[model samples]
Target: MSSNPDNGPAVSRREFDELFEAVRTWGRWPAPGRGAWNRVTADHVRAAASLVRTGTVVPIGRPWDTRPGPDNTRPALHHMSDLGDVEPPEPSAYKDFLGADYHGKSVTHLDALSHLAYRGLLYDGRDARGSVGAGGARFGSVQELGPLVTRGVLLDLPAVLGVDWLEPGRAVHAADVTAAERALGVTLGDGDAVLLRSGRFRRRRELGPWDCGAASAGWHVDAVPLLGERGVCLLGADGDSDVRPSPVEGVHSPVHTLAITAMGVPLLDNLDLEALSAACAGAGRYAFLLVATPLNVPGGTGSPVNPVAVM
Candidate 1:
């Protein structure tokens, strides 16, 4: 695709609006409410619940390692502590706040909205509604992602391909999931939380944790709606979840940004995938309803979730 040079034509504001209007009219999906929207919503919800309730739940993510940024030294650490006084408190209290950047190991975490922003927008188009954005803070964040309980299905790619790590920019299609289900004799239920294990997580035990801030792996865009139709409310993976590189190049993370961000569902990535995978393989059964809830951090973009399997 050639870049539009300065010589290219420009459209007036009116023309732009006209173009938008035409597109909207030409390709508008009829939301259910216009005709039995309630029934439609109910059907989707039931399907989602059915799929997730019967599938196995595997939490697939890594621990959020906190290290120092340039502004991450001792003095700067005061910000995360939020001490009442401007200056550091007495020596006794100093140690209490020094470790915000080094939480060590903890269970159950949900990424705060402040940790990420979509095209400068927050979850549920909160920014478009003129709401404050996720500023990497977790207190009093986001609305409930609706009660999250469903069948969780795990697609073990490493187990499938007989490799240790999937190559970067790997493409996973709906057919792959279908094949896995057929081989495993498990059909997904509605609202199933599919936990994808790409085997990249095995490195933690092999190489130790990598440097913080590297991007994680994710599924392809084409897989989103297919899962959506099956009533998937959340998709959990072992990688960072979003495949689009930061300052994403002419693309969007439609899987989450469009699916959960706009459609009011949620996605969990960066979880502990290896342990969960081992548990399922040992059980020899891939059917179980999965359940997990992030701390109710209102106005938060996400919460760290230490999900458990209700097998």
Candidate 2:
């Protein structure tokens, strides 16, 4: 293993592979496509709903970014299809078109089980090349996962540590997760969605956009087992879940590989958790009802989303 001053001790490929095997959930769920989401039952939704007190709904997605930046290399596309200039019509109409390559830092999106692969294998040991093709994913498509409504536990690291935001490349270790849970008065539970808030946007607003792909605060590989043990159905973050300048060598995104490819847990990436953080702080609670409905694209690997949290 190597080490970085910002991200701490690095994990070698051997260590990452072992960690992947430790969290692998192959053949564990009856529905391989749904994966960990199957752990959420009707009771879980009802219980999550019960947590809504003030009925304050917070959207956790960032505004659709159309401008190119260091973080957003492939910006989303938006243009007017109709400007109400059609002739001979009784009524004029305006329309627009939208398109995105959302599997990057700019867009807030959900990652289905097909989004990542480790050693040419997807979750449940599906061969990536065979399962996913030019048409899209066959085995773990986003359509299979559908809508997700569950209890969301916000691990507000900035609040717990008395910082505005964790510095870029800072690794959120397993101990940090437990400490935040204790400080926030929330505990991880079965079928819950864990949202880690590093206050990335706050820093971006105060400073400026940086290449999050190059450096960002996020989960270290050491944290995956704790989440796996807690049976978290989903995972998300202000930044993509894996700490940039990845602690794991030979893996650009080890957390994505471990959580989505090995553990069969889907992920929400590039969320705007500032509002949700304040809402939780005001409510004196860190747990709330989270509702995320992905676009039902039959063979899509994932979809852009604006997931909501109700408290």
Candidate 3:
């Protein structure tokens, strides 16, 4: 195993495969397409609703970026489709168009079960090639998992550690998760959505943008088993939820492989958590009601999302 100063030792392929088998939740639910989202029952929604005390809502999606940057190679598309200058019979309409290749590092998006494959297999052992076609995914498309409402626990690492932001390439391990839980006065529960805040955007805003795909502060492989054991249905972060250069030697995105392909958990990527961090600190609570409604796009691997946290 290789070791880095910031992220500790890299996990071997054999070790990662073993961990994958340990956390694999294939066939655990009746609906194979919905995956871990099946754990969020109606009761869970009601419990999440109960956490909305002040009704302060914070949107977690970043602005639709149209400019090219080191991090955003494929910038989102936004243009005036209809302007008032158009030939108007009575009243002119002003409209705009929005499009994105959202599966990258820039857009805030939800990754469905079909988004990733491990060794040519998707969640629940669905063969990647056989399940996903040129058009879109057939087995575990975004349509299968509809609107998601659940209790969200924010593990604000910077706030807990008394820092502005954890520098890029730092690894958040399993022990750090427990420490953050204790520090934030919250506990992980079944069907809960966990959002890890490494203060990524804050760092970018203060220090300028960097290529997060090359290096970022996020979960180490050691944290997956704890989340799996806690029965977490959703996982998200300011980054794409994997520390880089990856802790797994051969794998580029080990957390994604373990969480989505193995544990069948959906991931929220590139969330703007600065506002939520302040709001949670102000409210003196880390737990809140989370409502993430992805676009109902049939056969889509994932959807660009603007999730809201209501406190």
Candidate 4:
């Protein structure tokens, strides 16, 4: 295994290939699409619904970032589409427009199975070219994983470690995941959405923003095996879910490849988990009802989302 230039954990090409094969779920699900989301059965949603006692709903999505920076390169555009000043016949009216390239550092977005490809194939060994193209995805698009609702487990690593935030380039391991679960008195189960909090936004607010795409604290490759074993349907984090200055050689986003392409699990990226963390801590619980519905764009790979956690 060759180490990344930033001195992150290194997984050799052969090791990555082996890992991919080990966790592959190709043709495992009975249905053709939806992938791991198929695990979220009616029972799972009912159980998750039971957790909403206080009826406290917290939005975990970051605000629409419109400023230009290393993180928000494709800043979201918001402009007044209709100003009532044009014609004041009777009542005043106002309207606005919003647009963004949300698949980046600054926006909270969900990644469908079509977002990643390995060896010219998507999840279920479908040909990337045939399933995905200029129009959108034909196979595992956002439409396939409709309205993800299930139990959400928050692994607040920063809170567990008693730190404001993990430093950049810090790679969270499988051990950390277990430790956080123990510390938070929660257990992950089948069809659960696991959200790892590295306190990236807290650090940025306190110490100023940096190029998260260049270096960020997130899951290393070693953590995926345990998550797969625990049957986590969705994975998310304050960062893009991959430790930047990627650990695997020749692969910039190993977590993305393994989670989406190999295991067929969707990913939630750039979530604002600060408030959710506080709410969980106050409630003395880490699990909640996670409700997220992606925009139903036909053939689209993924969509910008505003996911909510109800305690």
Global lDDT of each model? 0.48, 0.94, 0.94, 0.92
Give the distance in Å from residue 158's predicted Cα in candidate 2 to where it truly belongs.
0.4
lDDT of 3 by residue, 278-301 (tens): 999999999999999999999999
Model 1 weakest lDDT span, ten residues long: 31-40
List model 1 lDDT by residue over 162-213, tens digit each: 7776544454556767877776667765556677777655755575544323
lDDT of 4 by residue, 129-242 (tens): 998888999999898888999999999998999999988899998988889989999988899999999999999899899999899999999899999999999999999899
Instruction: Rate residue 187 of model 2 by lDDT.
Output: 92
Which portions of model 1 show Cα errors greater than 4 Å?
A: 1-64, 67-129, 133-143, 208-216, 244-249
| Two-way lDDT contest, 3 vs 4, winner | 3
Return whichever of 1 and 4 wins on TM-score: 4
What value of lDDT does candidate 3 attain over all alpha carbons? Answer: 0.94
Report clashes for each candidate as comma-separated counts: 44, 0, 0, 0
What's the lDDT for residue 160 in model 2? 99
* TM-score of each predicted structure versus truth: 0.61, 0.98, 0.99, 0.97
